[model samples]
Target: MLGRRAFLKLFGGSLFGLMALGGYAFGYEPVIRLDVTRYALTPPGWTPGLKLRIVALADFHACEPWMSAERIGSICAHANGLGGDIIVLLGDYTSGTDLITGKVGHRAWAEQLATLRAPLGVHAIVGNHDWWHDAAAQRSGRGPTFSHRALSGVGIEVYSNRSVRLEKDGHGFWLAGIEDQLALRRSIRWKRPFTQGLEDIGGTLAQITDDAPVILLAHEPDVFPAVPSRVSLTLSGHTHGGQVRIFGWSPYSPSRYGDRYVYGHIVEEDRHIIVSGGLGCSIMPVRFGVPPEIVVIDVG
Candidate 1:
């Protein structure tokens, strides 16, 4: 029903638009865009008169051309200027996908991350990819994974089912980190396939001796449901904003909850969770509406 010239013009425009989107997703966003997303909240039961600024970096799937050591160093430098009281590293330091042209070694990325600074300290927790990529840890079916050793070697305290109390301005609170929830690949048992997790939420929470408000650092947002209201806030990475979110909805998410826990700040039943879009690519080197990000949170 259309003239030849009109139809050709419409087709050409659509094709060009597709090409531009592909280029942006594959080349520009993943390689060059680094966003700093900030959130401010007063969690329930938070100590009065205590204000804390948290700078968090996550999912540095370090690999050549995508996330180089120099780039990570630059990110750390930027984070240092943010005047955060504490810095937290949410996991996936290893390359998460085989699409990399060259793999960045653990030490290279770890050394760059060591440059991160905060008045309180820099704490870390490993991700699923960190465990999956560590052959020795996978073989033994236990941790200290290679990622853990590298982060520790760089003077970063990697928390595994651990809780530590931190104070600021004479106000005290507990920071708890649980181990990866998908650390091991298990064989199918009785016609069902399930991965084994190293996370011990109960054990970690038990370490908190006082009634101080707790802030939990979990690598994957999928654990949010099990988190009790005792935890004031839960910070997480690993969904990577579904890796290609559009219109605040991710078409594909690795989380079992799909778009429910795919990205950003979420609150349910008076509990709060902030999931970082993260700083690297996983599964593939492509990004759309959800660009790589450094997340900052201000809590009172």
Candidate 2:
């Protein structure tokens, strides 16, 4: 088996060099975003006068052959194609272990993928990669990926354990983004006071009106099982439907969480979870049983 880096060099060269001849000639790269616009939710005692559509893309890893600027643009175009009102991105911007090499690829690709345009607005939280040097090391020798500034430029809100309110038609909802518990490695040093649980973020959620429906976005599904039952819905990505599935099942997913939340919609009573296949690839560039996905959720 070839090393991941070596494979990327070969794959990226093929992808970029083939550009002059027109689009790459390997396969039918698509601009497909799963249309879940019909996904409906009715909070108790809530009148249905409003509709909300969100585009959720996650685990970018931003690798060479899998996550090219061209491909991401395809996904973005697909998202815009949705007549939906709002768009949200989960996380994981790039995939690399070496900071220097990773950042170079991230900067180059990030510059290109920044063209996403959405109507209600785009929001995101960092994935393990975006934090685990899941990004560029130092273009000029800088830092890791979590950025309110850089992502904001692309119209994606980068949130870490934060919340915001959206209201219309005399009804309202609260959206909260919590820090990734799975992404605990990078945050160890700075966490002086030492907090053990995600409850630290409950204060942010408190800002919302108590009766309003609330939605949460956390990158890793590992975070979902722990979310308080109070949260109405949670959105996530990072598994990539095991990135490579055998036959049709994700042979690679090892968590006890099961395939219940693998890819697509999972509804349990009032608790709903959406795990997107995302627009990029990681760990390995090739995909089987899973095409990269952009998930749209219509919550009213």
Candidate 3:
């Protein structure tokens, strides 16, 4: 049997530990930690002798005191130093949670992102929050959402069910980006039954005119299983590695498939997907176990 003094000490210690963990999650991980995660792979049908380095940033829920324009600029500068052949922005540029002290303007972040430098240029795709938070687009069930317009206004091409071809050292491949899979809410009043998606996977793939290998940029990893083998690789964010993970398991994942598509490299049926643990928080401003990351992929 435990003594009264021992029980009291144990309870106090546990409370202190919990408070300390909460402080780290709220103050340190999301605000100050930035990790550079790297992966290298040669997809099943990639062109021979062709090497591509891709630097990707995702889910910048831009807000004051969290993801400010100056912070974004610093991140962009770091990415530029990486010497990527191409850079991809993986969406959710707007504030994802209402816990922000102040919202970041679209143009402010866009202007900072414009500083990003890559030989093949910068490309972008929209995320669910980009559509859900846009009042005009949500009301109308369509977009040129603010995120899309802001990115395009800054000279970065934002793809919506679009494909473009790029070459490196004479080897050509198609880069495709589809619209967000959860672009709109079925009911703003109830916010349930989110059945609508702006994505057109088949339509996007159809635009690829050649047999050259393809890289697909999707905002959510849920689309990976449905991705055809024709696409050599699919890159995604939006899960943020469940925002709080423990021992490679996330207790609360926003993904319908849960931890299966939550983070890192996933392979199925000769197809590959890399899901980034994105920068910034959503639903709440807290992070633990999974730190903010800039993903770098070397593909052949």
Candidate 4:
């Protein structure tokens, strides 16, 4: 029932409103997500008397020009301060393949990560990236500047996927580290294969009384398939929980073995599997649905 002039005025106002809203709708927006999950589980062999808390960090592609030394040091300090009795660093230390050739990028990368620390000891296992880099370290002449010694210098204990016993608070638990599923390459030159020298899940755990708890630290969650049922809990940080899961699903994870292993926690066949969305960036310097995380897990 409005007159022509009034109709035009109303149309102009409505059009202006739509235009303003549409501008924001098409704005450039980078997607970002942060998820924090607190998991509490009763492992098959957890003892009633002792409590063990471990902070896990992984997939820190600490290559130069990305993760600076100061930044790496800060993250390490933060992980150690989580008040957990133990801290673990899963590998993917650098991205360059020049370690064997002794290059600047490799050296700088290792030196930075050596800064990370923990109280119960910062234990670690190599990822495929670690294995790939080792090939570089094995190079001759102007070999790359990085070395496994870099981690040792900073007091980080790199564990070959094998089990070791720990006595804490008068009670003892076994901390088992496994060579990555990609251990095939690491075994070619090393004295013994990862699956060898290390206790098979059954044998490695045979000596530990049923009452003692076990914490398995591996670089990738794929190890879960081969891990024995005895390990109370397994901590891993590859796949970054899919790094970019949408609606609770990750689009892709570079788990050499399979993309089925994204990131986050999984319980299969009585094993508590926790995969962390590591602290640093990788090939595609971006994380959408999955933000990097430092988990403080408490077990009693």
**Candidate 1 lDDT over residue span 163-238, tens digit each:** 9999998889999999999998764432226788989999999999998999999999999999999999999999
- Give me the overall lDDT of model 1: 0.92
Clashing pairs in 3: none
- Against the true structure, candidate 3 reaches a TM-score of 0.96
Per-candidate local distance difference test:
0.92, 0.61, 0.93, 0.63
Best-to-worst ranking by lDDT: 3, 1, 4, 2
- Model 2, 110-199: lDDT tens per residue? 555576666556777766666555334312222334443457665557676778887655667777887655543434345423323232
Candidate 2, overall lDDT? 0.61
Off by over 4 Å in 2: 1-38, 43-47, 96-104, 134-149, 153-155, 186-201, 254-260
lDDT of 3 by residue, 1-300 (tens): 879999999999999999999999999999989999999999999999999999999999999888888888898999999989999999999888889889889999999999998999999999999998888898878899999999999999999999999999999999999999999888856564665898999999999988999999999999998999999999999999999999988998888898899999999998999999999899999999999999999997
**Cα miss at 289, model 1 (Å)?**
0.2
Prediction-by-prediction clash tally: 0, 7, 0, 18
Relative to the true structure, candidate 2 reaches a TM of: 0.72
How displaced is residue 230 in candidate 4, in Å? 0.9
Give Cα distance to truth, residue 47, candidate 3, Å.
Answer: 0.4
Model 4: CA > 4 A from native:
1-37, 96-117, 136-147, 183-211, 256-260
